[model samples]
Target: MKSRWLVNLALLLVVAGIVAFLYLKPQEHEETDAVHEVSNLKLADFDRVSIEFPAKAPVVFEKKDGFWYLVQPYAARADQVTVQRIVSIVAAQSHEKLPADDPARFGLDNPRLKIKLNNEEFVFGLYNPVTSEQYVAYKDAVYLLSGLYSETASTQLLEMLDKNPLKPGEEIAGFDFSRLEQWQEVRLQLDKGEDGKWQVSVQNAKPSQDDINEWFDGYWTKIRALSVEPYTPDRRAGYPTFSLKLKDGKQVHFEKLQESPQLILGRPDEGMRYTFPADIGFTMLNPPVGLGK
Candidate 1:
């Protein structure tokens, strides 16, 4: 009976060993096998990107002075986050890769979209029904990548536009609110003093340095618009205009387009309209006065 019990124990140990080995071996194999990335190109190295879709003009972006700018479909500042998403295709990885010898089988013969990062071009084709991955042809090979790459490339031009009212890295030195009805009499301007501190033009209203800085840096400097679109030229003229003077001696002018439901500010020079929530919009024009006391 003891011999029989020992034999049963040995069989159980052997079964446990087999289960452990079977579970760990596949993990070891997966670790050794490196998945292939779609392209060898690095994001920082490629400064130019051009995305072309079927029956639509190609949109292009160029990096200048460490900032991305939309170079096609009318020039404007490109949203950094959106551009990064489109450019990230270069680093995309794929489990399956095949030769580009037969392009039609994967729909590469007539690609749905083409994205060029500098000189390296990636052609997007049909989606794989089984895996639901997109077929992309780059260089001599075709790769299966997530459909997100194609979706980001297909984003509308306006959606890609930067929503910030001011240019990236621009510092506001002062605001000229002389044209605004409420501030016209006071000639309200928030300008930097000779000591490099912020001061308001209103004589009766005295706000602390911290109060001014909070409004400038915490609010105006970091404010982002809800949406941005091309400005319409036919909009009613003589709208209240305000200008922000930057530290570099450049002024960005904004015309108040709407007030009640939402506040819309139009930059005629850039031909862009910036929409903002009405509550926050009023504070932009009206600074903190006597609040510091």
Candidate 2:
């Protein structure tokens, strides 16, 4: 009888052990039966991005030389932080998933915004008024995601480039200034010689001064806009304008605003424009003069 009781107790203990393993075991390695992928992407793998808008052409940004640069419409510098933000938010997991049975219900038939990240594309659809989330179509799958996708969609081309006329770590080897003065062009420029000295030159005159510090004490150590405002330029409109050509073939073409004292800066090649305070504008316009801040 004792032996039989022992066998029954052993079977009960074995059964309890199996039950504990089946019901009480931690699911550390088991995956939940849910998929929340928005893009199924690793943001680091993408080297290029194109943000497309309904009304405007897509702006392409490429990763080159360890930095992001604009490669469409016009070649220019790109803001790394801006690009990273878009990439990060897009690659994140979708907040919620929804049925994609109806195309017209969520604006999938005509997506207003499209973003091409390397091999994948994100098509933005309607907003979920109830959840405050957005609908995005990727491949044939649709997901309800955060509304942050619109942030990248609404970005302007000029917003991608560095606002400063002179990028950090860039030193100008020469600067050529010219403007239409009463239908005649007047040119004044300054060049840095191999000896690392500055020289000033005017129309038909040889370089006379080697010192530029006499202008603003020490402004050439850094040349930047105190602040900038975006403005669209009239490409064909011929008015009195000036050009400050840098060593890298990029030039700042600008003209004084007609109604205001502010100076309008233009990148003719890129068709981008910016405005600067009159005080700062005149300083950049006349390089040989004092520009003390």
Candidate 3:
């Protein structure tokens, strides 16, 4: 009888373990066939963009040779980060559907912001006061997407310009300067000694290594343009006073323009000129007088 009772207890424990296993199992998320994507098109497939805001003319951006360029208002370089952010947010999913009994009531008639990715266009409308979601009209469907989409797509033309002038392709090794300070001509060369110490030389004299390093680092790695202007073909006059040579054998030439300009730097190869303060030239081109002075 005791042996029979022990067998019955073992069976009860096995059943309890089975029940506990079922209870502790993780259930899969429900899958649905319905798609509520804000943008049916992929961002990679879009080669051009046209953005319009209420009471403002549309600003168009075109991608050429894998680089984004502004094609409207003024032809210039486009900020890739700003453009991609808008495309990524719109490409996301939105499941919330809001009532659209009156188009005018939800700002659908004239969307506050409109974005056309390639051939397809989307309109951004009012924000729901209670839920704080935004209304968007795309492909004959009005969606109540997160308000974050509206905020991202709203961008200004000037804000989308690339602040950095040249798409310099290589790490800078060193640079050459002629008539840098109106009287001084310098040719800087950076090389590592057998001991792996960096040394910079100007002509036959070795100037301050710290000053040369600081100039090169700031000019190449950290310089930002004040503005970029469209290029017009004309006599360039002469070679650049300041020339930056990359490690990859590509040389970037710059020519200063006009008198007393806050910004000046022109690149004829890309056909788009960039500008920085006139004082920057003075700061960068002024070399150290003598080492250990």
Candidate 4:
């Protein structure tokens, strides 16, 4: 009887040990299942989204032609980067504790911008709790809110280049009068040397070979960095317009004929006309218009 009782006690201890081991082990298999479930979500599930901005307007985007396009106020160009960012935000898993009574608090309100998917639109409205004043919408959604402004800046500068009349070896005749601080201190003269090389000189100073090359390269750099912003049209009256003196020795004086900033090349008789989007250009040292502060 003593040996049998000892054996029964040993069996009970073994069963208890097995139960504790099973309970203490990590749930590795369960975690693997959870990860697989999240990874299985399909991108095609979200076909449409809508974005509405505060106080301004709402935009709807549809995936057509294998790309997204804005359908409201005429089919305008859509920024692809903007679309991708919105889609990613919408598709991301929400883990934050949602408000019990109001989900709209976390919804689109006082948003910097809004985007719309296929059937549903994500609205963004700004809520200034401190100021009590909210600006709901951006004026030009495509141009103002989207990242395409950089591209627009480049295009505008290129357009302005089209109106300029400067050439490789063409001279622009103008005397630098220090007394009249209305124009640039140095006058530019372009000439071709006997060696068939382009030369740019300022006044009587003969530019070194390195100086000429540097100046030429600098001009191109300035052209690339050009940008335009909104300016007051009325400020044209304060600007001093330059009078072009052509190589042919004819003077063409320009008054602020149009409020728009433009690159006036050559003498009025023989020159090219280039107009920038705004008054900001290399020639104008002080930008005339305030670019939205």
- Candidate 3 CA-lDDT value: 0.69
Candidate 3 runs further than 4 Å off: 1-36, 54-56, 99-102, 146-154, 168-171, 182-201, 207-211, 226-240, 257-263, 268-282, 287-292
Clashing pairs in 3: none
Clashing pairs in 2: 215-291
Ranked by TM-score, the better of candidates 1 and 4 is: 1
What does candidate 3's lDDT look like per residue over 60-124, in tens digits? 88888887888987777888888887777557776765555677878989778888888787778
Q: Could you say which candidate leads in TM-score?
A: 1
Count of backbone clashes for each model? 0, 1, 0, 25
lDDT of 2 at 141: 69
Cα error, candidate 3, residue 253 (Å): 2.4
Residue 107 deviation, candidate 2, in Å?
Answer: 2.5
- Per-model C-alpha lDDT, please? 0.88, 0.66, 0.69, 0.39
Highest lDDT model number: 1
TM agreement with the true structure for every prediction: 0.84, 0.54, 0.67, 0.30
Per-residue lDDT over 77-162 for candidate 1, one digit per residue giving the tens place of the 0 to 100 score: 99999999999998999998899999999999889999999999999998999999999999999999999988998898888999
Best-to-worst ranking by lDDT: 1, 3, 2, 4
Q: Per-residue alpha-carbon lDDT of model 4 for 158-184, expressed as tens digits? A: 232222333323343432222223334
Candidate 4 TM-score, C-alpha based: 0.30
Deviation of model 4 at 266, angstroms: 19
